[model samples]
Target chain A: MPWAIAAPNTPPPPTWGIFTPGTVGQFFFVIVYSAVIYWLISRAKAGMPVPEIRKIAGLDAFDEAVGRATEMGRPVHFTPGFYAFSSHTLAAFSILAHVASLCARYDTRLIVTTLNATNHPVLEEIVRQAYLEVGKPDSFNREDVRYLSGYQFAYTAGVVGIFHREKVAANFMMGWFLGEALVIAEAGALAGAIQIAGCPAVVQLPYLVASCDYALIGDELYAASAYLSKDPVMVGTLIAVDWFKMFITGLIVIGVVFANLGSKAFMNFITK
Target chain B: MRRQLPVWLGFIAGMLVIIARYFAFPGFTQVQKTLDNWAMYSGAAAFLMGMINLTIVHKTNIQRRRENWGASLVLLIAMFGYFIYGLFTGPDDKLFVSIFNATISPLGSAMFSLLAFYMLSAAYRAFRMKTLEATILLAAGLIGILGNAPIGAAISPWIPSARNWMTEILNTAAMRAVTIGTALGAYAAMVRILLGIERSYLGGRGD
Candidate 1:
């Protein structure tokens, strides 16, 4: 035992070799980050100051899109993008509920297309409930909530076909769209439908902007439901998010200045 | 009750996985992994459910002599061919891969490319220089496009530099704001789901 201590040269086990300061530090950082997110949410319920959101042009066009359909005497085509289960999809679903309710109130025909078969029953129910809530239960059409093919391109083709055949006056595309964003938007354009598109796919934003009358770029897609429905929790969360953003921006500014001055100690302390 | 049981189980399983990932507990992590494996297997099995549903629909279409009868026949043949190919030659076989790559890939690309033409037409028809906002959008788009292109750089280095600055500084700030807002919204939605307040997923009647 004395000889082993004196030597003090043997490497640790292969798995434990990298169990150094950096590894320990990173492990702790993740824990702290997660804890902070949890704490933020807990404290957020108490209420936060509302952040002033600059007007989103895409949202202002919602009424215009609906009005166009009404004027044209054509049904509104609303596809909640391709995602059926994601957070983006849920946001889209919430928006769909609002839009359906509005359509019911306006006595306008609403056509919903789902790329996924599983989404059919849920979407049908959503439409039914929305219509009932608006005192227009009879306006809800089972045939309108059609489930097209699950094949991505096939679904796009089917939607485009419908747009051409029905001459949909207004087209609302919101959720997790991919390459099909431009294709769908273009079809709506060809059909003379006033198109409003919202997708988190940044790469596809250019296509949407070029094709659709109104495009909700990136994160504004998430704000669609909140803006439409004015839910307290939704609005409160939006405010909390702004506070978080402000905190991040302040940290970035301070960090930049400190790093420029070569204050390693201050930088490390602040980062920690 | 069947749906409710699954939903409850899903909620419990989801919470356990999150906790396991956060806490670095070996036992919890193992449980989470096991549950994930089960889910993967179940997902594979669920493919049969979809296949069955599709078959039923196509069969009905054929029996009723629906409007798209020829399309139904083509679909049935393709499906059966796919199944036979998988059964006899395996999924990694050259024939299967070649057919998929040849048929599906090009069709997908062609479909996606349709957007470009549509965009040009849409822009021509809808993008009127009517309001101040519209003017601003048109200007920003033009600048953004020019900045990204090689032609802009060839004409003047300042165009590319300006584009870089706009993308890095202005766009980054805007994007960050949106990300924060989205994250908060998602967090709120997750809370609603956890508390069983958002029962839209459960369809109607709330169970």
Candidate 2:
């Protein structure tokens, strides 16, 4: 009686010791999505043309930011926001790799301040490798990749201090940010640093966009690694994602239309 | 091996979670639960790493007598002193709680208060009538500000209605679109990681 009341008007899912019945749709979607990605990856590997991702202004500014620091003989500052290991941080790492390489090539100083300690060692290694890749391994300073306070506002204070003390030429703030977003970016702006910022946090997006010279909005932060790397595999994966978005859009449209026609069939299929 | 090991582990763990989520397989729930616990444990372990790093970095600053070395010394004293005190008295102890409330809480709040000033500065720069979009943004910002204040309703009934429409309809729609796009982007990123294509997290170049 309790089970019936809890799941009123719903029959039990038929299971054959395999896929969960209700999850069949999601499972199939994942398989199709993965297959599409893999196929695109293979095509990219074979040098086949894929849809070129549009140029992102924030990513395009990376080299320019590093070069400005070099020309001005000032250091460039970067932080991957206040989060620990997450997709956003991973994307930030890709940007850092490119920035480090550019700094190495130009012999400009790059100072990385990390809020998450676990990300510190990884960031250090990326900077070191980037310098090595650019044939300037000796120029790499481990001390420059600093692990600042883990507390959100404390990290912001540290970044603000760096901006004021070092008088950085360029500042890059990428990854997940929260209330502290404007504090750091505005500090950079006040210090006369050219700033580029990206964050997936919607609430903080306005602050970053308003303060930073260039801001990567929404998924742009995720797209950054692929955009900057210009690697075939990465680019291919991005294209596949776009295709899947179109598919989802189509489903949404269909569901809307069916609902308008007084049919719950499509809606039930999706909700199932 | 240093690089490859992490990639394999990530792939394995990712697949396990995916299967456990979508498949009616037995024992996978237990596996997922175990992995989640491991993740929690590692995160706690990483905090200790953060402490060690903080000490080393600040110690160097003090040794070199770097600019603001005094601040570093104070930070170290505060950090370790508070830590040791907490260890002995426990976080629930009145003294420990009082110290946190006295120092860290107030300091954090003070830093957060700076955001209002920063926001004003940012808004000043952003609201400049340099472009059409900026002009629209300025209009929207004014509306949003007015909508939140008591005087806005006094100005005109329509002003509040317009602000409500903008916030409820326009802002919500835009935020939802961004949220959708971000979800897809994150999914793509995860796919890359699972496939061993996105290796930047391994402290190397992405494939």
Candidate 3:
């Protein structure tokens, strides 16, 4: 049998030359999906009254965490979950910029440790700019921005060490965390620091939920920076995402009903 | 211009990567491959830059006699020593691999095993039956664990079936929802950057 249905004993036909045929549906949606976001962004930019977006508690806690750090006279620690450039890391950086600004405004020390060699300079620059934007450039300490290690577990261990040694007041974890998430998050918890963690890695949610005071579950992590910044364009993108999700969820529920009622038509239609 | 250049470059490069995926244009793949090759080279250069940065930071610490500066010294030695050794023997050489295995393998395992204890702690906290939802979650988790364990078969024949059903049905459904939501969220974020709406990642740069 062939991978999705074909004549028995027949060699699989040549792959589709145009439009990665198997993925055309998803590809088409990707375009439509971005278009929807663009449209919403435009609307908001035009001063349209966008509906109030749902509150993400993890996001709401960001300033609170930063404030706590300031009050406690301890530094704030930030690590974007994974290393290198990806959507997860990119999203995480958005939050990092925000957190850095908070640290700068409060004149509290900020420690950023990274495992990705490429992101190191960019992260540092972001923090520096954040301080400069807040008119506190001289207060920014280059030494506090660390490139811990290129190794995953080594970075985790180093972060744990920072949590203990620095006695961090607030811990922010966001990005593409893998197996090292729990090790680091637990360290933050043990240090009695207020923690807000978010990652695209679904399996790591349990650890974050248990250890962190607030956990950005799933896409909430992605929506975080937009949610925190409250810029019209960013908020518009979020509004678009939420609307699209509702639409997709409706389709899913209907498709499920049809599937249960003995119909493959919806599946075939979507897959096509 | 400084800010605008990165936005334009990112948009063009990202679109090219996306286009190269679905369209098998004659030279598109080659162009994409070339771009990727350039990225890898840049990443290697970045690695060197990172090493230099690490050295500078630690050297300052040592000079200042800062707290735990000895650890910084050891870190520098280990880092540069490994770098020199790897340069001489190549990354895949037996000695290099042996050293890597001795260091990373066990350390990674230790970190991974720490997950078990952390998981237990997390589970104990999360699985508390504080509310109806928590109780249901606890039930589902217990069933999932027992179903995977050998003892489930010994405990009750129906338990395994229940666990399998929950995983194959409920767990998969929830996971699908999460995966799709994340994909869309990521997609929106990508579009935002492409459109230059989310330019903070560009570090307070241009329109």
Per-model DockQ: 0.33, 0.65, 0.61
- After TM-score superposition, the amount by which residue B82's alpha carbon in candidate 1 deviates from its true location, in angstroms, is 3.6
Candidate 2 Cα errors over 4 Å, as ranges? A1-22
By TM-score, the better pick of 1 and 2 is 2
In model 2 chain A, where is the ten-residue run with the lowest total lDDT?
A7-16
Tens-digit lDDT string for candidate 1 (A10-103): 6433223433222444445434544554454445455654445557798888888887788878999999888656777776776677677777
Ranking by DockQ: 2, 3, 1
Candidate 2 CAPRI-style tier: medium
Interface RMSD of each: 4.7, 2.0, 1.8
Best by lDDT: 2
How do the candidates rank by TM-score, highest first? 2, 3, 1
lDDT of 1 by residue, B1-207 (tens): 755674676578768865665454568868988987885675456455545555765677688897776787888789788888888998899988999899878988888777667766756644567878667667666677889898988889888888888889987877676665556556555545554444444443233
With candidate 1 superimposed using the best TM-score fit, by how many Å does residue B41's alpha carbon deviate from the native?
A: 4.6
Q: Scored by CA lDDT, what does every candidate get?
A: 0.70, 0.86, 0.85
Clashes of 1: 0
User: Evaluated on chain B only, what are the TM-scores of all the candidate structures, in order?
Assistant: 0.85, 0.92, 0.90
